[model samples]
Target: MFADARKIAELAWPVLIGQLAIIAFGVIDTAMVGRYSAVDLAALGLGSSIYISVYIGLTGILTALQPIAAQLHGARRYSEIGEEVRQSLWLALALMTIGFLILYFPGPVLRLARVPAALHERTLAYLQILAFGLPASLVFRVYSSLTNALGQPRLVMILQIGALLLKFPLNTWLIFGGLGVPALGGPGCALASITINWTLAIVGMLLLTKLDVFRELAIFSHFCWPVWRRQAAQLRLGIPMGLSYLIEVTSYTFMALFIARFGTTTLAGHQIAGNVGAVLYMTPLSIGIAASTLVAQALGAHRHEAARTLSRHGILMAVLIACCYALMLLVLRPLIIEGYTPNLQVAAAAMPLVLIVAFYHVFDSLQVTTAFVLRAYKVAVVPTVIYAVALWGVGLGGGYLLGFDVGGAIPVWLTGARGFWVANTASLAIAGFGLLIYWRGVSKRYLQVDAVGQVR
Candidate 1:
């Protein structure tokens, strides 16, 4: 158990760092744009919510490549790994087209939020520019996922840290205007993201071509047409995975949309709270990814017991770390929200939400780790149903009734963004427990099968 924990940490730390760097882009945008203009800040909040939903949904599909590649690497099937990479790229391109169209024509969805005219135009522009970067973003996701599954998270980490360094300068210049560049405000963040994403994609591909390890697999040696059988297999796993992500993200996405009705101050506050939650999520998410990679590889090698052990350790570590984080967040809630904006009202509005987010971290960690582990087992469909019922049905639906005070039963304290935050916290708890129970059942079944085979 101790040795397994170390292995998880060895792989998880780099992924944690890389994920933090990626998440910083949003944090920087929120803080910098919050200072630029309240309107821009609100637009940033709304625009990013929509963009994240689209991005996560699409990338979730590409993530199917991780387990497939990890298992292949463990089985020592080097050549087959290359073909999976090719098929994934094909899938990425197709998904990109769908994502791009949704982002480009975001008006229909934006209407659901009923964003005021002051924020709508800028939010629309933000989504449109992000649409231009969707393809590059998806391409880099393929690179990142492939590297991670092969136990090469450091490769992705280095690039992410580099992108973050670039992100600060670009965000500063484009957002506030400098070097003879006119300030683009909130939309500037989107522009900077596009530039950075494209750079990462191009350089990542170049590295794949030059890297000794990657070269061994000949990932780019030849272009093969999409194989329907492989594509179908990928989609079979990828679609539920994608929908699971979509359901989880859109639950929060809809929260932002519904909270928009409260006012810009409240919405901006929600963004701050949400961004902080995302930052804290990196640690557990990295652990989940590391464990998933190792588990998939172990299963591939027919070491089912090892895979089960790794999953158990990963969950234990994530929950413990999350508890520590939750305590720290509760203690520092005020100081943290202060950094996001100078507006007293916004900061005050975010206080309770951040307080709730502190505890939300624990449940968030639980659900995410279990979800990723389940994916490694190629058991996605059940989790998707769990998420949809828990996050969407429970989280979103409950938030609506509480936030809107449907029939006027909600308490005064729970009638606005507070209501939404409370509901989401509860929903995470539900989703986490549900996924954990399901994971245990799956593990038990796998062990039973192995035992029966051994007796035979």
Candidate 2:
């Protein structure tokens, strides 16, 4: 147990730090823009939501690289690892084209946000600027995934932290109009991100050449034309992963939209609660990524028992840590809410929701960790379908019924945004259990017997 725990920690800590640093860019933008101008703050908020939806959904597809490369590395098929990355890059470029179009022409998202005429231009500019960075971001995601799969997560971690370090001063200068630059406000934040994405991608390419670990893969060996067959293989795993992400994101998005009907304080409170959950999620997310890498490697090495053990151990670890985090959130609920805002009304509304999050996180951890383990097994279609049914059907649909008291059955406490939180929590629990069961059955197929019925 201790040995496996140690291995998971070694991999997970770097991933956690890297993820936190990457997310800090958005945090800085939010903090700085809030102080810069309310109008700009509103624009930043709306534009960022649009950007994240696009980013998460598209990048989720690119995550196909990690498992594929990890297995190849484990099997010591080093030559083909480069080819996998090459094909993934082709996939990334194609994805980038779609992402770029969506960001550049975000008429639908903007219309959904229903921004005032005065702020619409700023929002559009912000998204358009961010569109320019989509290629760089997707390309870098490929770089990060490949490096992590090769058991070199620290390298990607360092690069992500460096990018985060650059975000602060850049945001300060651009958002506030200093150092001979006009204040572009929300768009300025997008510009900083664009520059950082390009820099990260460029540095990543340089590392592939100079880094001894990656050099053997010859990932940059003469650019071959896209092999339709290889690209199709990646798309097989990637498309469902992408749709799962889209469904999950859209669920929360519609929740926010519906909750807005309850008035400003309720919406503000829900956002604060949602942000706290997002932050806590980094731990499990990192664990899931690390575990997926280990599981894929073990599977590739034909150590089916080891793969199953790692899957179980990873899920257990995430849930245990989530329990601890839930306790901490409960005890410090007031302090945490205080940190988000000084408004008593917002605090009052947020406090109960934070309590809900404490409970919500346990299942959230379970689902994310298990989902990644399944991904390691090259299983995505079923999980994606499960996510659609669970998150959209149970979560969003149930939330609507409870939040709006659709049948006049909800008690006062279960009505409004709190009801949404409750339903989301339940939905996560369902997903967690479903995925755990699926993983057990699937892992058995690989672990218990060979085709001739002998133990694997």
Candidate 3:
């Protein structure tokens, strides 16, 4: 168990660092653009929210390549890994087309948000520039997923760090009008991302040809025409995966939108609390991905018991770490809130939400880690259903009732963003336990099937 834990750690740290670096790109953009103009900042926020929703849903489909390629690598079917990647590239292009169209033509989505007239042109320009990067970003996701499955996440991590390093200077230059460039404000951030993404994609592909490990797979040696049969297989697992991501993103998006009704101070508090939660989430997410990679490999290698054991240990580790984090947050709540803002009113408002996150982080860890493990088992559809029921139905629906004091059944203390945080916490607990139970059942069934095969 300890050995498996160590292996997971090895794979997880690189991924965690890499993800942090990618997240920093946004942080830098926000900091720079926030200084440029308030309207630009607002546009950046809206534009980024739209871009992330589109990117996550489409990349979720591309991520099906991870488990498939991992299983193939474990079984030593080297050629099939290459073939699966090729097919996913084709799928990426198709998904990219859909994503690009939505970003380029943002009128419909903008109307839904009821964006202010002042913010419309800037936001549209931001999304349109970002649209051009979608193709490269999706292609790089294929590269990322393939490497992650093969337990070579360092390949992806290095490039991510490199991009982040480039992001700061680029953001500074483009946003501030240095080096003979016009200060494009919010749109400059979009341009920076486009340049960085294309650089990563091109360098990543070039490395695949240059590296001996990838050379062994020969992924680009033979051209593969689109195979509907294989594409169908990917979509079977991917469509639900995509929907699950969309559900998660939208749930949070709507929560923020609804919380906006409470006014600026409350909204600011929610953003601070939400930002902290998002940062903490990276830990469990890394663990889950590492575990999924190993578990899928074990299953592919016909070591069903090993796969089961890895999954169990992975979840246990994540939850235990989450508990520690929760305790730390509980103890340091005041200091944490102070760091996010100097306003006493905002700090006071954020205190409760941040406190909720202490508990919320645990269940968030639980659900996220378990979901990733299930994906290793190629069991996404059921988990997607579970997320929809728990996150959307219970979390969002319950929040609306409690936050507004609907029917006057709620106390004043529980109304507003606090109510939403409390409800979201409960919903995450449900999702966590539900996904854990489902994963156990699925793993057991796989073990039973393997036992039967051995008996034969």
The candidate that wins on TM-score is 3
Report backbone clashes per prediction: 0, 0, 0
Clashing residue pairs, backbone N/CA/C < 3 A, model 3: none
Q: How close is candidate 3 to the true structure, as a TM-score?
A: 0.99
Q: Which candidate tops lDDT? A: 3
Give the C-alpha miss distance for residue 422 in model 2, angstroms.
Answer: 0.6
Report RMSD for candidate 3: 0.9
Q: What is the lDDT of candidate 3?
A: 0.94
TM-score of 1: 0.90
Model 1: per-residue lDDT, tens digit, 185-213? 98998999999999999999999899998
User: Against the hidden reference, what TM-scores do the models get?
Assistant: 0.90, 0.97, 0.99
Find the number of clashing residue pairs for candidate 1.
Answer: 0
Candidate 1 achieves a global lDDT of 0.91
| Candidate that beats the other on TM-score, 1 or 2, i.e. the better one | 2
Q: Model 3, which residues run further than 4 Å from truth? A: none
Clashing pairs in 2: none
Q: What lDDT tens digits, residue by residue, belong to model 3 across residues 224-300?
A: 79999999999999989989999989999999999999999999999999999999999999999999999999989
Query: Model 2: per-residue lDDT, tens digit, 1-456?
Result: 678878998999999999899778778998998988888888888888788889988898998988999988889898799999998988898999999999999988778767789899989999999999999999999999898898789999999898988999988888888878998888888899999999999999789878899878998887888999888878899889989889888899999999999999999999999999999999999999999999999988888889999999999999999999999999999999999999999999999999999999999999999999999999999999889889999999999999999999789999999999999999999999999999999999986665445633
Give RMSD to native, each candidate. Answer: 2.7, 1.5, 0.9
